[model samples]
Target: MKDWDYGELFEAINESYEEFLANGRGEKFAVARAFNEYANMGKIEDIITGVAIGEILASHDKVFIGYIEGITGWLSEVGKKDLKNELSDGEIENLLGRIATVIRDLRNKPIDSNPVA
Candidate 1:
């Protein structure tokens, strides 16, 4: 993965929605484009920030997904299940850092094998 600037990622996500809202295209088209951008993140590369942005979007009701579930689902998946609530920039960075570290550690863990006794 490329070195990520989570701060930049957060700004980009906010900018994207704001831009979409102001776009000359109709709201439907703008939303479609936004969603396309979300889907394209995986196509271009499995950038953690991209996925993170998507999850952030998912936490909001403005996108037609659902009411705000916060990021609990994501946190739980990464094994930090207890974390919940609105967050400041620094808190978000710390959470993302922990998630990234856990992901890295899991990726690097050796596969285990057992012989039949």
Candidate 2:
């Protein structure tokens, strides 16, 4: 039920990205790690984490389809839903659009509103 600030989330993601780069990890892995960390923190729900990951992947032109599948599989494993089944192959644009709609819907909701409600 804690309200999340996207600014703080982005800052954390950026820091993680820098750290991952310093350690020779790729951007995709960094993003995945950040998503996992934030989701596991219990402040952000799985759907929000998925949306964040979708947005990050969409922004990166070099992201491979395998990365998307890996993230979707990870989300499915952790969120306990078959999100990978929900996504169609080569539909990254559609996926990003859906994530954007979710983000907009979240923005319209009250800060105290239950995301899972």
Candidate 3:
């Protein structure tokens, strides 16, 4: 993909994130509008940032999806149990800690993946 695509994705992610933060942290219409705006912008750098942010967010989303699937699978195998007997407080804390570490690592990864500037 083009470098500018990353910028646009990043900007869209940021705009969505901003709306989430401002609007009680749930999906909303404004976030979607922001995404549309970012997609329509033609500047390469803008799009590149959007792509960078989107990549990071997408990675995190994937990780979370995996985690959820794993947890659900485990619970189902164990007779569809809920948190009441599944995870201890320590285990929950550890899982959250690992997620936080992942987020930090993703944030630190270089945005420029292209060979040419």
Candidate 4:
């Protein structure tokens, strides 16, 4: 086994995303015919929770929740409430971009100094 590589990981995740769109649901209904199975188990939550924040973060959810509350307060200051509802596909793009940037920065920095702030 060699050292881990994130470029490969990113490619794998993108492939999963492509698969998500291929056989995706478009059900028939009198009132609605829309994309289904796109919001449930194939969600980005598990990826974010497990990798971006690390599994150890689950034990620090309270601390992270408080941090998120602080972020919500900042959003409110910018006239945005219910941020989750406001977020669109753009949010996913932003998260992916940030992940790539953070990974790049981390690779360039020394481990003992904690590049992940």
User: Which candidate has the highest lDDT of all?
Assistant: 2
lDDT, candidate 3, 28-96, per-residue tens: 333334445555444333323333333334344223333234323332232112222334556435434
Q: Ten consecutive residues with minimal summed lDDT in candidate 4?
A: 26-35
Task: List the candidates ranked by TM-score, beginning with the highest.
Answer: 2, 1, 3, 4
Which segments of candidate 4 are over 4 A away from where they belong?
A: 1-43, 50-87, 113-117
7-116, model 4: which lDDT tens digit per residue? 34344434444454355531111001111221132234323322332212222312233323332333223312322443455654554555444344333332232212
- Residue 116 C-alpha lDDT in model 2: 25
lDDT of 2 by residue, 28-96 (tens): 567656766766655234554666665565555445545455455544434223334433443434444
The TM-score between candidate 4 and the true structure equals: 0.27
Q: Per-residue CA lDDT of candidate 1, range 17-105, in tens?
A: 56986877644454445545544443112233334444444433343222112223343354223323334556556766755653443
lDDT of 4 at 77: 36
Question: Judged by lDDT against the true structure, how good is candidate 2?
Answer: 0.51
Q: After superposition, how far is residue 111 of candidate 1 from its true place, in Å?
A: 43
Local distance difference test, per candidate? Answer: 0.43, 0.51, 0.40, 0.32
Off by over 4 Å in 1: 1-3, 24-32, 38-75, 80-93, 96-117
Error of 4 at 7 (Å): 25
TM-score of 3: 0.29
TM-score of each: 0.38, 0.43, 0.29, 0.27
Query: Which candidate, 2 or 4, would have the higher lDDT against the true structure?
Result: 2
* lDDT value, residue 97 of candidate 3: 46
- lDDT for 108 (candidate 3): 48
Tell me, by TM-score, which candidate is best: 2
